[model samples]
Target: DAMVIQNPRYQVTQFGKPVTLSCSQTLNHNVMYWYQQKSSQAPKLLFHYYDKDFNNEADTPDNFQSRRPNTSFCFLDIRSPGLGDAAMYLCATSRDVTAQYNEQFFGPGTRLTVL
Candidate 1:
């Protein structure tokens, strides 16, 4: 099946330590997005890659960083994990942006645990 894949469904990291979560897709979509979803709150868009152009949300914290080596893969790098940072990291992909809209497929999120 050609779909988005997130590795290390569960991750445990010490406070202030760096952790990297990876996402890859076989869909070959042009746009890939990363979202941080906490317990009850709405998912927050952290960043995205539209082809080679990188877009980061204005309110995204400095602790969140992302890298896309190519069209099929992206990585979210957390510089310093905190207790408050423990949440589900979701990866999604879309073909292109349009005035009307297009659907994005999301992966089974990676759950991060901070200790």
Candidate 2:
């Protein structure tokens, strides 16, 4: 009965090391998103794939990247796990039916810890 799943709810990585967080949804939605959220801060949109149309937020750092090879799956790859990259990585999904307004359903999130 898992609608959305994220592997390794908590992850630890050394500084400058690469880490990848995964997310999958059973909802079969067409739109998938990745967001980064720090303590007491709003979740910032990193990027999203709207049925293969990749849309990235202008302020997203170059060290952060994401990929959606197919529906129901998405991955966030951190090129370098710096101290600043330690945060909660949240994955969300929404239907592509109505572009005007669509609410996103979030996963449990993977908390990345950089040492």
Q: What TM-scores do the predictions have?
A: 0.95, 0.93
For this target, which candidate reaches the highest TM-score against the unseen true structure? 1
Model 1 agreement with the true structure over 46-95: per-residue lDDT tens digits: 99999989999999899999999999999999999989999999999998
Candidate 1: regions farther than 4 A off: 99-101
- In the predicted model 2, the residue pairs found to clash are none
Q: How many residue pairs clash per model?
A: 0, 0
lDDT tens digits, residues 44-75, model 2? 99999998888999998899888888898899
Question: What is each predicted model's overall lDDT from 0 to 1?
Answer: 0.94, 0.90
Model 1 gets an lDDT of 0.94
* Cα distance off (Å), candidate 1, residue 53: 0.7
Q: What is the C-alpha RMSD of each candidate to the true structure, in Å?
A: 1.1, 1.5
The best candidate in terms of lDDT: 1
